[model samples]
Target chain A: QQQVKQSPQSLIVQKGGISIINCAYENTAFDYFPWYQQFPGKGPALLIAIRPDVSEKKEGRFTISFNKSAKQFSLHIMDSQPGDSATYFCAASSEAAGNKLTFGGGTRVLVKP
Target chain B: DTEVTQTPKHLVMGMTNKKSLKCEQHMGHRAMYWYKQKAKKPPELMFVYSYEKLSINESVPSRFSPECPNSSLLNLHLHALQPEDSALYLCASSQDHWTYSGNTIYFGEGSWLTVV
Candidate 1:
């Protein structure tokens, strides 16, 4: 069973637009949520992360809106650029579960110039 | 350096061949993980090592053996693998194990493996 589920298998946005990707997880024990950005033939790099304590966290153009009560979180890329095109993955992990990261079905985002 | 280095970025082997994938991290992380990823799919956990000791083995097959020589090194031995086992092998690490918050796992540039 997939504990974490992500929506919109893929999305395309115009430059300077907003790209939003959402994910919902079933496990309530999950307290840590992170988003990773991966390009072709490269490793997934940590983009942004948010804990349940905060409702939202923003870093540069990347923002993570987390809803602990809803068991959901979303990633928003502001002013999307063609260089920002890549696969974005949402992951959840609980310290109780050995901190093993559970990843959602990735969302491929493409920004057109 | 906050990096996990994996060797042999790409490897192609026959069914009867034996090979190994090496990973090294210098971030003083105590937890290391091995994740297998297929094309266009999320990575699947295979093994976890904490403080240079085996912690979790996701019931992986015996054909895949994992080793932790030291705190900063991890190795995966592949032998007599089937074609279906071919995928990108990723190595990851974190500061510590069993931490609820603020634990960010860093990943290495995966090693692509092909079995014929």
Candidate 2:
């Protein structure tokens, strides 16, 4: 079962623009939401995360807007740069699962300079 | 440095061969995980270990076995794997899962496996 779904399998944005990716989950049990960034030939790394308690989080130019009641969340890259080009995955995990994350298919983002 | 280290960055093996992928982390984390990722696909969980003990097996096939010898080491044993098993094997570690505290999972470079 695909517990989480991501949209726009691929995205292309110009530099200095906003790159947004959306995701939704069917399992309400998911309490922790995180975004991961993966470059070619490398492992995925945690980019940013948010819990249900908050609606938004910002770290540098990366931001996560979450809606608990809607079971949806999104990642927004402000002033997107070529360096921000990479595949982004949104994942969720619940306490019951013991930290086993359910990841979204992923959104490939390319920031054209 | 906080990192998960994996060995044999790349491997090409026969279907009948026996091989092992090793991972180690030194971030004082008690939870570790093994995930498989195919081209253009998100990672899928295979095994998880908490406090050096097996905690979760995502119904993975018996051909793949996970062993956590100690708190800092985790290994995945491969035996008679089919060509479909070829994928990137990723190892990750995070804080104790019981806390319910949001812990960031860290991943290693991953071991690329090609089963023939």
Candidate 3:
């Protein structure tokens, strides 16, 4: 079963514009949600994360808006740049899973300059 | 360092050949994981190790074996594989086994395995 689902298989954004990706989950046991960015030939790196307790969390230009009751979350990148072009993935995990993340299919983002 | 290092960034093996992928981390993480990813697909969880003990196995095939020799080391053993098994093998580590606070999962560069 796919616990986490993401939309927009690919996204194109102009430089300095906002880029957004959305995701949803089915398991209520999941309490931790994280977003990862991956470049070609590299590993997925943690970008930002949010807990169910908070509705939103911002780190630099990246923000994660989470809804516990709706079981949904999204990542927003402000002032998008060409360097930000990469694949993004959203993942979730429960406390009992020992941080074993269930990931979304991934969204390829292209920030055009 | 906060990096997870993987050996042999690329590997090409035959279906009958046996090979091993190694992962090492220096962040003193107590939990480690192995995931398989196809092109344009999200990573699929294969195994999880906590405190050098096997904690979760996702009903993976026997052809894929995971070993945690220590807190910082993880290994994936492959044997008698098919061409369809070729994919990127990723290793990740987390600070603790119980992740109620969204512990970050640091990943390695990934090992690209091509089975012929």
Provide TM-scores for the models. 0.97, 0.97, 0.96
Taking chain B only, the TM-score of every model is 0.96, 0.96, 0.96
Candidate 1: Cα lDDT at A60: 98
Docking quality (DockQ) for each candidate: 0.72, 0.69, 0.72
Tell me the tens digit of each residue's lDDT in model 1 across A13-77. Answer: 99999999999999998888989999988888889998899999999999999988889999999
Interface DockQ of candidate 3: 0.72
Q: Between 1 and 2, whose DockQ is larger?
A: 1
DockQ-based class of model 2:
medium
Worst 10 residues of 2 chain A by lDDT: A93-102
True contacts kept of each: 0.67, 0.56, 0.73
User: What is the TM-score of model 3 when looking only at chain B?
Assistant: 0.96
Please give, for residues B23-115, the per-residue lDDT of candidate 1 as tens digits. Answer: 999899999999999999999999999888899999999999999999999999999999999999999999987655457889999999999
| CAPRI grade, predicted model 3 | medium
The TM-scores of chain A alone, one per candidate, are 0.98, 0.99, 0.98
Off by over 4 Å in 3: B99-101
Per-residue alpha-carbon lDDT of candidate 3 for residues A2-103, written as tens digits (9 for 90 to 100): 889998899999999999999999999888899999998899999998889999999999999998888999999999999999999999988876577889
